[model samples]
Target chain A: MATIAVIDYGMGNLRSVGKALEHVDARSRILVTDDPATIRRADRVVLPGVGAIRECMAQLRRLELDAVIREVGSNKPFLGVCLGMQALLTTSEENGGMEALGMFPGEVRHFTACFAEAGVPTPGKVPHMGWNQVRQTRAHPLWRGIPDGSWFYFVHSYFVPLLDDAWTAGMTTYGLEFTAVIARENIIATQFHPEKSQTAGLALLANFTRWDGTA
Target chain B: MTLAKRIVPCLDVDQGRVVKGVKFVDIRDAGNPVEIAQRYDRAGADEITFLDITASSDGRETLVQVVEAVASEVFMPLTVGGGIRTPADIRRMLNAGADKVGINTAAIDNPDFVHQAAQRFGSQCIVVAIDAKRVSGADEPSRWEVFTHGGRRPTGIDAVSWAQRMAASGAGEILLTSMDRDGTREGFDISLTRAVSDAVPVPVIASGGVGCLQHLVEGVVGGGADAVLAASIFHFGEHTIAEAKAYMAAQGVVVRLAEDP
Candidate 1:
């Protein structure tokens, strides 16, 4: 049986994510924990987060889950959701420039701030609450059963501004194109909330459980 | 692509049991809130709102249990309203697995509560439920007035401006309910819905007075709301979430259709 560790640094809604994963595949033992040993032994890992990037980083470092995350994320199949996805990037403009895990070659930016920097109109809202369609840019295992233009639940103001497009697996448009999903080797992350996204979301979670982390 | 207009089913719970009444009077039991929420979730409801109608001392504990039970079964967003007064209340609900917390009476009492809650918990989790009644007089333009205490007392606050203020104060969404058409099932107050939807940058959920599937379509099309919420029609089995989505989709409104079971 594949054991999945949903990293719990006490920042996000870990309950819903764990429940959704269990609903997707009951046989897969899903454990929500911050214990380094348990996380290290898991076959697959899920990093779920919400709230400000500064506080998220604080909690992550305080629990020393940050180093464990980097180690597990590099070795096994890993998935990140929302702030967990953003935290993998180099830096975030949120809370006066906070440094992140520096795993991915990108920086997180506010919706309007990025638009203004790029000389474009403001997107719809700050948090980008509710559901929006995710357009797949490149084929991957996570997109195996999910449709190309499936709507996923999104709730965030800041998004990853990809410095390297090679990692971009999916892109979505609000006022401008934003990185929706990024994957490379053994890692996959999405800005949208697959757990809250209904059918397509459940399908994606199912795919993740079955994924071997190949391109 | 345009975001799909959501059809949310609301459950008014009193001591762990789902109940419905006319304007908060003559209440009768409906079913278990957790069971009803799970049924709606399986039926393809976009979201579920569990409102603790009787937010009594022990009712909080029951509501927490209902939320936990429902959250384990349901996979979509859950918004809990009624008796959420402070940041701690909001924290308790979120910890109980609620995606959003709706503040009405307490919000009116302290406008700063909206700001504080939004700041503490990201704005995406803060929802301000505004109960409004259309006020007509020579002194002011034909506008809706904000009502608190389940629409029994009027606050004299303009609905449109109050919504804008709430949004500015960091409210991620607004749950606007029309007191006049709440239980009448006539239809959603489109004008009122439109006024608030247009006034705010955040998403607005048009609630109250959902009689038929057509009313739901109108709530999205005519009212320009991001989502439409109904209770009695769905509770009474007049329509299912799939039925409402089909009607809205046929009317050229983008709604998430249920996949084949």
Candidate 2:
């Protein structure tokens, strides 16, 4: 059985992530501590978060889990969800000049400018809450069996812009084509909350559990 | 692009137990909230709204536990309402794992509460639930007035204006319920729904009077609501989320269908 360690950082939707993993028959455990040993020993790691990108990075740094996260992402199967995924970027426009986990060479920016340029009526909205579909960019193991144009639960205003096209696994349209999910080597992240996405979400979690930690 | 219609399952809970009744009377015990929530979650509900029907503050504690248990078991957004008065109550519900806290009677008593709660918790966390009843007048027969305190009192506030005010006051969403259409299984009031949806910029969840899948479809497409919230249709197993989504998709609405697991 796969022991999936879900990192909990006093943020959003940790229980749902853990429960979704359990539903997929994964031996899921919620890890609130920043101890490197626990993260190192886990078969897989799931980082789930919701909130401002800078606050999330600050918390991870304060708890000294950033190094451990880097170590785990370098070798093991690491899944970043929502803000957790955004934190993997190099920088975020939120909270004014805060560094991210730097797992991926990308920048997170608010959707206001993008939405305005797209001519959407409501721009600068803090939270984009609802169900939206993701358009797959290319084939990857993370989206192994899932069909293209599959809808996932989304609730965020900021989006990640990957430096390279190879990092974006899927893109979704709210105001414009934004990176909805990403994969690079051993690291996989989704802007959508798979936990709240029901069966498709569970299947995604199951796919992660079945991953052999190989790119 | 037309917005995707949402299928929401509403749980009328009292003292941690889900209660069902005809026209909101003779409440029969259904099941545990946690159990019911998991069932709905598996059934592919877009969202789940738990209305704590009990009036007492003591029931509030049970509601918190229900929210916590459901949050742990069910992997979906949870909106909890009923007896949520102050900003502290909203905070408590959010801290207890509720994604949104719904305010009803409090919003009627003091509309400022909506603005304050929205400012404090962000508009996304504050949902204003409006219960409206059709009132016949000398001028127009289709006049609607806001009802609060579990539909016991009439505030004489126009439902459309109330919805607009709530949105202006920073409410993220509106759960508009038709008191007359509730538990009737007759279908939603398209006029009331359209009025509220047209009045607010935020997402409007049309509640009450859902008998079949078509009603859900019309509630969104015709009624112009973002989501359709129902209780008996889902609680009685009249249709599953997949069936509902398929029906909506057939009707030309963009719905998120659950992939076979």
- Tell me the number of clashing residue pairs for each predicted model: 0, 0
In candidate 2 the C-alpha lDDT for residue A159 amounts to 82
Residue pairs in collision within model 2: none
Candidate 2 chain A: 10-residue stretch with minimal lDDT: A121-130
Query: What tens digits encode model 1's per-residue C-alpha lDDT throughout A1-215?
Result: 98999998876578889999999998899999989999999989999987788888998899998999999888999999999999999899998999999999668999877767777654465667777788888899999877788888888989986546789998888777889998989999999999888888989999999888887
Model 2 RMSD in Å is 3.8
User: What is the C-alpha lDDT profile of model 2 across B123-201, one tens digit per residue?
Assistant: 6678899999988765875779998755778898989899999989978889899998988889998889988887776
Structure candidate 1, residue pairs in collision: none
For candidate 2, what's the TM-score of chain A, rounded to 2 decimals? 0.91
Q: Write the per-residue lDDT of candidate 2 for residues A43-70, one digit (tens) a residue.
A: 8898887755656776788878899899
DockQ of each: 0.51, 0.27
Cand. 1 TM to true fold: 0.93
Model 2 DockQ (Cα-based): 0.27
- Could you say which candidate leads in TM-score? 1
